[model samples]
Target: MNAVAHNAQSVINAAGSTLEFLSFTLGKEEYGISIQKVQELRGYDTVTRIANAPEFIKGVVNLRGIIVPIIDMRIKFKLGTPSYDQFTVVVILHLENHVVGMVVDSVSDVITLTPEQIKPPPEMNSALATDYLLGLGTVDERMLILIDIEKLMSGADMGLAERSPA
Candidate 1:
């Protein structure tokens, strides 16, 4: 085969192996949350810090006059202390009955994933608790960590019962 033909074939192979990820940086690690869960992405804006809330609860933002509590994923995962700068962003997520925001370092892009491109997380990868991870996906030669948005947004830690006091 000619050199030009061989180079083109290589490019095709590389493209075929690429997977899509909604990439964002948490601490120093690049993580991927499913694009399906994402409602919108916005630049870092002033947050009305709420009192008596968890430290990770960065507070509420007036998104189009609707209040949304922003959770810092770094703190939620107990990854490390979080520092913010110009690159910080808030990713709004839509759940069953509500919409919440999660803060990440920055958002990269949306990439696609294939079956063979993903693998189950290793045991003891419990930094953020691998139980919440659907799996790990490889896209563009990088690993996109898949997260279960339902599990993260359900407020399972709040221990709020469905029925109120009668």
Candidate 2:
């Protein structure tokens, strides 16, 4: 076989049924989302405040001519008073129609895990709804709360339901 064919086979075998997640921190816990949905990462910056927008909606920022809405997950989850220090970051996500940016405490490295490593999210009563969670990912000593970024961003609480603010 040629070198290119050999390399392709190696990658396919190594990646067998594995999924990648972009891990990030919120408050004191770690969370993750599908890496394929992530467009890019940027440092937290000032946003234009919108009238009647939800508190969690920190407003919007222009990303390459696109008005991308920024949501502070800390505020949405009621973690605590969010602090925008140097470590604060904005995770740019590419949904079906809109490109949204999520403000996270800090971003960690990407994690790769197989289907077996991903366990069902435990039943619990909390600010984070189970419908927004994909599952719990376990990688060695770390536990990542995998979330459905697309669904969460499109939820009613995200100020993108169906009615425009009047």
Candidate 3:
């Protein structure tokens, strides 16, 4: 093969191999979710409260014509009481058959991680459920807790949806 043909093949191979994560903060720690699931970002706004719902489940919001349930990640992770500040934002997620919104302290940016950059989750009993954790992604000196957003959102404890994800 010609040198240019080899380089072109290399670029094509590399382009689709990387996965993107939308990085956000809950407190001091950083977390990431699949960028493919993210629909859009919106500033913190009032949500209609759901009676007798979990504290972490902030409530529901009318996004366009669809009602989306907003879950506060900070509260769910037990980081601390969340304050609706300028930095507070909600990430609209497009899950199977429905839409959900996740609230975080602030959104950093979308980061792409190669397969080599992602390490398997530690084999230790931790506060956060290991099942929902994707792994640790290293970018430069920063470590991001990559989360399986779909699994976490669709878990039995979530109570946000009736039908289980297939």
Candidate 4:
């Protein structure tokens, strides 16, 4: 077989099994979430804080006239106090019939990960338990904490339906 034919077979052998991760940084660590769930990326905008809302919630913002809840991912992950600055961005995610925004320090880029590239969570306990993490991606010298955004930002704890503030 020619070299091209051999390469084609190799590619086919790795089919149906790759996941793309949207990578971003929180503090000094790199993290990733499945790209399929992300809707869009918006610059850091002024948010209207809701009274009697959870602390992790950044607030509500008018996303093109549609009200969307903004969540501080750093707070959700219990990393540290979140700061709003030039690098801060709101990443809109769609999950389970709800559209919400997640705040991140900075966005790196979208990365493709095959099953082989993903690794299990660390045996020791982390600030974030394994339940919140999908897995870990070890690429070169960097470690990407794979986060399940839907599970992390599910409106369940946010009490979204109980209050309507616009």
Give the worst 10-residue stretch by lDDT in candidate 4: 3-12
User: What does candidate 4 score on TM?
Assistant: 0.80
Once model 3 is optimally superposed onto the true structure by TM-score, how far is the C-alpha of residue 51 displaced, in angstroms?
0.4
Error of 3 at 122 (Å): 0.5
Kindly list the per-residue Cα lDDT of model 2 for residues 107-135, writing each as its tens digit: 99999988778776665556535677767
Which candidate should be chosen as best, given lDDT against the real structure?
3
The better-scoring model by TM-score among 1 and 2 is 2
Q: Show pairs that collide, candidate 1.
A: 19-112, 20-111, 20-112, 21-111
To one decimal, what is the Cα RMSD in angstroms of model 4 from the true structure?
Answer: 8.6
What's the TM-score of each model vs. the native? 0.76, 0.84, 0.86, 0.80
Model 2 segments more than 4 A misplaced: 1-16, 125-128, 161-166
Candidate 2 vs candidate 4: the TM-score winner is 2
Q: Per-residue lDDT tens digits of candidate 1, residues 1-166?
A: 4333343234334646654458898977888776767889888788898788888888888878667878888898788888888899899977655678899988988877765676665556335444456567776668777666656566566322231321
Which rank order by TM-score, best down to worst?
3, 2, 4, 1
Residue 120 of model 2 has an lDDT of 63
Clashing pairs in 2: none
Alpha-carbon error at 164 in model 1, in Å? 14
Among these predictions, the greatest TM-score belongs to 3
